[model samples]
Target: MSSTFETVAGIMSETADIPRETITPESHAIEDLGIDSLAFLDIAFAVDKAFGIKLPLEQWTQDVNEGKVPAEEYFVVKNLVSRIDALVAAKGA
Candidate 1:
């Protein structure tokens, strides 16, 4: 697995109390792992601290709330991994 996926899985493991083995690229944060909105905020904060990348939590949430971004897009593990990897690459660049 990519470091981005590992880091995200680790955070979800702790925040959602789900086993690391159970977390997969296709896992849905809300449906599969039972991560609520508040837990997601905590996960976002943890990701920022762990990777030194800032996720646009407020903006993303607003977009989702306003129906601009689908809620499922935000809660899918693979999608989050892709976004984090992009951010990390951007930071390194």
Candidate 2:
């Protein structure tokens, strides 16, 4: 899991142009990462490709865009972490 997080952070740093040190489990996707909508989409695609798990960005955008994320806005890194957590939990490994 730690390795996964590191990989995720690397991806965000490289692709999203966010600083690697800016990422942590506690970092808010929007507030801390500063990712806009298009960046969010790019992050989502990158995460899916890197982790080999398909995150449903369209549905996620609909929910998060409508202010349903409970954070009042979108946060790409946090969403990526959530998706990773869900997929990891589902596998029961």
Top candidate by lDDT: 1
Cα lDDT for residue 60, model 1? 79
Instruction: Please provide TM-scores, in order, for all candidate models, with all chains considered together.
Output: 0.89, 0.72
Please give the CA lDDT of all the candidate structures.
0.88, 0.70
**Residues forming the 10-long window of minimal summed lDDT in candidate 2:** 70-79
TM-score of 1: 0.89
* Cα RMSD for predicted model 1: 1.3
Model 2 regions more than 4 Å off: 72-79, 88-93
Q: What is the lDDT of candidate 1?
A: 0.88
Model 2, 1-93: lDDT tens digits are 476778778877887798788788677767777877787777778877877676666776678668777543335455567668677667666
The pairs that clash in candidate 2 are 29-75, 30-75
Model 1 stretches with alpha carbons more than 4 Å out: none
Q: What is the alpha-carbon lDDT for the whole of candidate 2?
A: 0.70
